[model samples]
Target: MDPILLGAIFITPIAAIIIIGLIWYQKWNYTFKDLQHIKGPTPLPIVGNMSELGDPTKIFWQLFNWQIQYGNIVKGCYGMDMLLLISEPEYLEFICTSQSTLPKGIFYRYLHKWLSFGLLTSKGKKWHQRRKMITPAYHFKILEQFVEVFEKNGNILVEKLRGEVGNPSFDVNIYLTLCALDSINETAMGTSVDAQNNSNTDYIRAIKEMNRIVVDRTIQPHKHFDFLYQFTNDYKIEQKCLKILHSYTLSIIESRRQELLNNPSRFDSKYVDEFGMKKRIAFLDLLLQSTIDGKPLSNEDIREEVDTFMFEGHDTVSTCMSFWMYLISKHPEVEAKLLAEQREIFGDDPKRPTTYLDLQKMHYMEMTVKETLRLYPSVPFMMRDTLEDFTFRDLSVKKGTQILMLPFYLHRRADLYPEPEKFIPERFTAENMSKRHPFAYLAFSAGYRNCIGQKFAMIELKSTLSKVLRSFNICSAVPEHNLVIKSEIILAAGNGYKIQLKNRTW
Candidate 1:
């Protein structure tokens, strides 16, 4: 036998064997078995049900339809990836409440890179530690201290809107985003970013870019390949955005440190009334003062928490406000009712902004906000990865499988919410709430990892809505406009929310 011929024969079989092993590994790692009994639309290879997700406008509706067809608990695959969609309240309770078994999925790893093990993305022991450290910042008493911040920012928002009332309708999303940014910065960071006045600040710009990039990554399948993302334009944008965000945060941290170092007496008892009383003891301050196991947090830890709060605090609340404003604009009856409630609560005091006490008294307003969140949660979907092989009911779910919970579908389930499409706030009344499952309304999510800023968000929403309603009457400029929702990091309207605002007679 020739030497060349023998070498070729040996190489060919080795190459063939390698190829076969690669194929088997791909199938073993990515593909799911026994999903036939679980029920869902047939998934295409590699892409899975991702093809159905391309159109943002129809994605949520289509997912809901799938839930209807496949029942409350549906199992599907996304490109060789196994995913379980749980819309049932009982199952959701199990998943959310069971902290030890399921952790945030791989999708959250992208967020973890930016947020760095903050409460939102951290899991198990790390999450437990961070959650405890941060819990004090969101205490009811601490939240009470921030009421003035909400009202002041809310008033500023109203003034800004009042200026726009005479002009043709403008996109309310921008204004809502600004109001949220301003509110969160003042209340959470104890500083004013003036987002409404200086909307193009480096921090604000970076945040918008970060949001855009994250959403883009979630939608683009090719970006999932680590090497591809590293070389892609999207990745470049993400890197630049992260740099801008971190730089801005570091500057703030350094400034605070210098201010404290230069005036150590600022912490003294005599200076308590002069400096301490007047000083802003905001969320960031609390985090700065917090310690664990006899050691204070490092700059890196503080940065992570601050950045996490900055992103989560503003975006979710803004998204909620955007949806709530659009809904109010579309439904004149609801708006009118809200206005009437505001008038009744304020009683001819148009200049007086709603206080925390006054806002708490606005039961109807709270219900409306709750209803809006139910209909259009900022986070439409949440993903969890199974830590171990688990069984729910009769189905066996394997480890590493992604569990997707669509709040968009859960909130609209006919079984859970009757007349699901209708904007009925009465359903949230104490009486009606008692009749419904607690997990059915998950706008801020549920269980231990539920939104820590829920109360703060509600306070901001109420104050802004009340003040705005007092000053101006909002109506949709294009009442028949079929506003499509863009499923990004936040649920934004595709074409923006254009609404007409008329200054009130009062």
Candidate 2:
């Protein structure tokens, strides 16, 4: 073979590829021109600032440090994509409350595998319709129905924790999460998953694995494409996990739908008892009977919403409750006040069931829970992708850019809340709270896209935490072990949420 002939074969294609690559790079790199006003670490080609973002476990704090250096509104790159992180109150207000920014970020595509285009990921008219339809399910009136479920599951948690009481320090979050799973299953589907009693189950394991794979895919750029991701091991695990989660949800939905068909009036015609309480109905029941465009929602659509909430409902409350427990253990003064409040609510019997009205009456515990959420919001960040150009001061945010609202960083801004680092529950007092910007604290997020079941979560947290405080005196392990924060899809303690419990004596 002649050298000229060999060069013609290999060099011709190589030259064409390089020419195409250069053209692609120029077009791709040109999009960040509008974001030039925002400050961030310099990005490398392809990988962008991800190399500097460091380990996934520390990405939460790495981004925080970047914010501290770059100012409130910061931008970073993952490949050619741009991500904006804002801690400024006005900016947060603009993005969260405004209709223009309602659609979730591009990464939510990952959740489509499990959550689908449910309320958590849906957009435009569909999002509006689903949200409007689902809103009634979470009304304070309906949330009251689940108070007994919370009380029962919370009580089970207390009874189960009896073994841990007066014992060595242990990861209380594991128990609390199982208890929360039980509560969500019972309240959301009108059935018991019995997660509290049997911690090791296929469904439970699938839930954990699915959350991990979702977060993993969201951050890694190459996995963003289904063409590439479908070939990976995580994708295989994701499908298996989805099978378990969806099959369980579908089975429950079918059973509940048949029950609804048998006695349609059972869901309607509210019958108030002598105690003035209506029958407890699960979130699943409401969806089964709900209509979209005046037609019944399909099983998949119903499953999307039901599974969305069920997935959203559990670990969030459990993580919040677990962190609250850890916070109280560290601050005996705060715990003392919480214990006093519990005594006032339950009086002499610490192991009493909490009515919805009773939960509403506990003020300090609610404040403490809010404070816990401030420090460690279950979803540390909420993201939005601009469908239309968005403006903040001189910055022109082009369409397709992602806006990351990190409450973990925003809630810590000194200007927003003076002494922001302190865990002072009093800051949430009505008078003190009035001094702060409304968007300054976004634990449950804000405005139209905010969490629909926030009130439901609040009631659950109050009911569960109050029960724990009433039954046991909790303390962090001796010498106060610190938690390594993992701020992924769910904010969690990389180190276990460890605590010791002593039986309560009043």
Candidate 3:
């Protein structure tokens, strides 16, 4: 054989082997062996189940249906990526509580970058430090100070409803959103946003824009590629929202800095006067005065914390209020009972908005609110990633595997609550609550990273509902419309909830 011919033969075989090996590796790399045991719908090549997942209208129901088919713990693929959907309470508890094992998922990395290391997005030691620093701000004693703000906002809502009495139809979502915005602004930033007054504040607009962009990003298939965000419209919107939000937060911090400088005594813990009651007003003020290891919070720290609170403070509470109103409108008996409870508590005081002490007395109202959360938790699902190899039900979850815990399904488990679909507030009564698992009714989630603003949100809901129910009778404007539920960071009614407001005769 000629030398050139022999050399060609050897090189051709080597190249063929290399190509075969590369192809084999690619196929193996894309496969998920562990998920073989768990049954799910056949996923399409490349897209996997992403086509089904991207359908915003049917995604939740589709997932719920999958849960029914594949049992509580179903494994599915999304574009070559594996996801474990955990619906069982026990599994959820393990995922949520096992922070040392499971951290927030990589999908949330974008949020972490945008929002900074705040309680909602931060993980590991940083999350712990931030939570510790902020926990005291939400203690019952501190939250009590914001009762008036809640009442004022609730009263504003009532006045708005009263003005529209006999209108036969109106969209309540916008109003609820505005009420939450105003209340959060006053409580969290110590600055009045005047959202209920229809003021188009840049901060409020930006917040709304951010939510819209987030929803768009979630639903749009092409936006899933993180690198592509820079060249997309969603990125532009997100950037705009971030700018307005950050600017507003920084401006508030600067104003507070000036105020602290002008009145050094404002930071004094012993500035009590005649009544012997210490007056530490405002959320920003409290945060500013808070120190860890005797070091004041840095501006960056304040901005991140404030932004987190502001984002959460408005969205979750507002979404809950909107759903609660819709539920009450559908159930007149429940509404009547709520009204009677309100009347019994305040006793015909026309000017009496719920006081902090008064809210404490509204036990029935609390039950109603709890039940509402159980049925329509503003946050339907939460994502966590495995930080280390951990065993769940004898199966190992390797580091970096995404874990999705759906509270929506868990809340509706028939075994946990008989006839779970039935709207029964009594399920949350003290007696009934004691019999269930502590993590079963986790509307605000469970364990160390549970919602810090849960108390404030509860108080705000109770106060607002009491005032609204006391003053007006609300009924759905279009009862026939099947209201679609969608999640874009928070659960919201797809078609804005419309209600008829009638002034209460009683």
Candidate 4:
């Protein structure tokens, strides 16, 4: 054979393998390449814009920088795939409200190891079914029943703070986290972790450790694959934490089921109605009996969902409350308004715990919470997988592309919110809210996939704030500009919110 023909034959097969691998790897990028005209920070060939991903803070900082440079809809890349950061409300409304775009994206996978295919992680038919099944758990009456639990926890939190009233400024994140944890335990599981009193409990420790590890996993692209994650020290620690968490929850679930079974009368008609036989108040009770299209959930399936609720219900609320407290501390005028509202609702007795109805009467305090959420949304952003090609104004989004909706940026839009950086509770009022685009303020997100626990969260916020303000006034040691925030799945302060508490004399 000729030398040239032999060389061509050998090179052709090797070239074919290389070409095949590249096509397979860059399939998503190629599919969305039509969007190349959309301006963003230039991405490298294979790794894309995943550089500096090891630091969670810098990862988000890059996104923010790109948003500033490129505009609301900034195009970026994740590995070999295309990503679009959508912040404008006009586009937000289209993506969030659409059922086709409801499926979660890559970052959510970091949570799935611990949470499994739960409501937050699941998609397609399974997600739709679980959503319907779980919807009733947050019913008005059910949540109203949870208010007493909220009030009880709020009282416990106030009592806890009473000791720290005159002490140096302390980070209240852990304190508030424990209170929220206790409330969720009692309300969601009908069990007491006693998080406030038993702060060193294994369950509490496990949850904290697990969250930290998850944050570590999310930022590092190399750790995203299961095989790579398994070799790390964090993975071993995560496994131990998961074991403690799962065991504790399983033990609690078993205990609760046995309690109901052993004593028939204890199963109140309010909780377990005759026809369908569903529980009333506790979220776990509903989960225990819940069926999707006449099929009941398995033990593993139930665990996934219960675990997800446990994580979301407590952690996010604590973060929100911490920031809420910090914001009130900085703005004494806002604090006075909040106190005035609390006084009007509670009257002569400042010690009275807020009822669900009391929460309803706390219109001003509610607005303050809304404004706080806008300033520091609990979940800064959400990821969605686009189901099909779509256009928002002039911009075109391709199918299978991941959409990063930055509620943090959207909430801070100067056009949408005047003096956007300022803490303005009045902005959430009916008149002011009516003027803004409905999707512009997405503290709890919006539309079909909005946070189901939003109302439950508000009740907890109002209940806790009412009690805290009634007992003590907030004073921040950390200056407004000095408080540094970083996005680690949820919005978190680098150094926790440090605020001194003064005993309120009503």
Better-scoring candidate (TM-score), 2 or 4: 2
Winning model by TM-score:
2
Order of models, best lDDT first: 2, 4, 1, 3
Q: Return the clash pairs for model 2, or none.
A: none
Best by lDDT: 2
TM-score of each: 0.91, 0.94, 0.89, 0.92
lDDT of 3 by residue, 1-506 (tens): 99999999999988887776565445423334544566677765455678888876777777878888887787765664557787776766777778654466655655654578777888777777778888788878778878878888888887877777878777788888899889888888888878899758787778777776765666566877778878987788788888878888899999998888898786564677568867556778877887877898887788888888888878899888888888888888888788788788878684675678888888888888888889889888877777776777745565656777778888888988899987888898899999998878778988766788888888888878788887788787777855678777788888877788887776
Error of 4 at 164 (Å): 1.4
Q: For residues 1-506, could you state the per-residue lDDT of candidate 2 as single tens digits?
A: 99999989999998887776575466345556776677788876556777766466877888888889999988786665678888888878888888878899887888887998999999999999999999998888888878888888888898999998777788889889999999999888889879988989999999999888888886676687889999999989988999999999999999889978887766763855569766678888888888988899999999999889988998898899889888888899999998888788788877667888889888999899999988888998888988887677777777777788889988888887778878899989999899888988899889889899899999999988888888888877756588789976889999878889998787
Candidate 2 regions with alpha-carbon error over 4 angstroms:
1-30, 269-278
The alpha-carbon RMSD values of the candidates against the true structure, listed in the order shown, are 3.4, 2.5, 4.8, 4.3
Q: In candidate 3, what residue range of length 10 has the lowest lDDT sum? A: 23-32
| Alpha carbon lDDT at 300, candidate 3 | 79
Error of 4 at 333 (Å): 0.6
Q: Pick out the ten consecutive residues of candidate 2 with the lowest summed lDDT.
A: 23-32
The sequence of per-residue lDDT tens digits that candidate 4 reaches over residues 322-420 is 999988889999989888887787789887656778988999999999998998898888899989877777767778889998888888888888898
Q: Higher lDDT: candidate 2 or 4?
A: 2
- Per residue, candidate 1 scores C-alpha lDDT tens digits across 21-57 of 5664465344356554677887654466788865546
Q: Rank candidates, TM-score, best first.
A: 2, 4, 1, 3
Per-model lDDT: 0.78, 0.85, 0.78, 0.83
Clashing pairs in 3: none
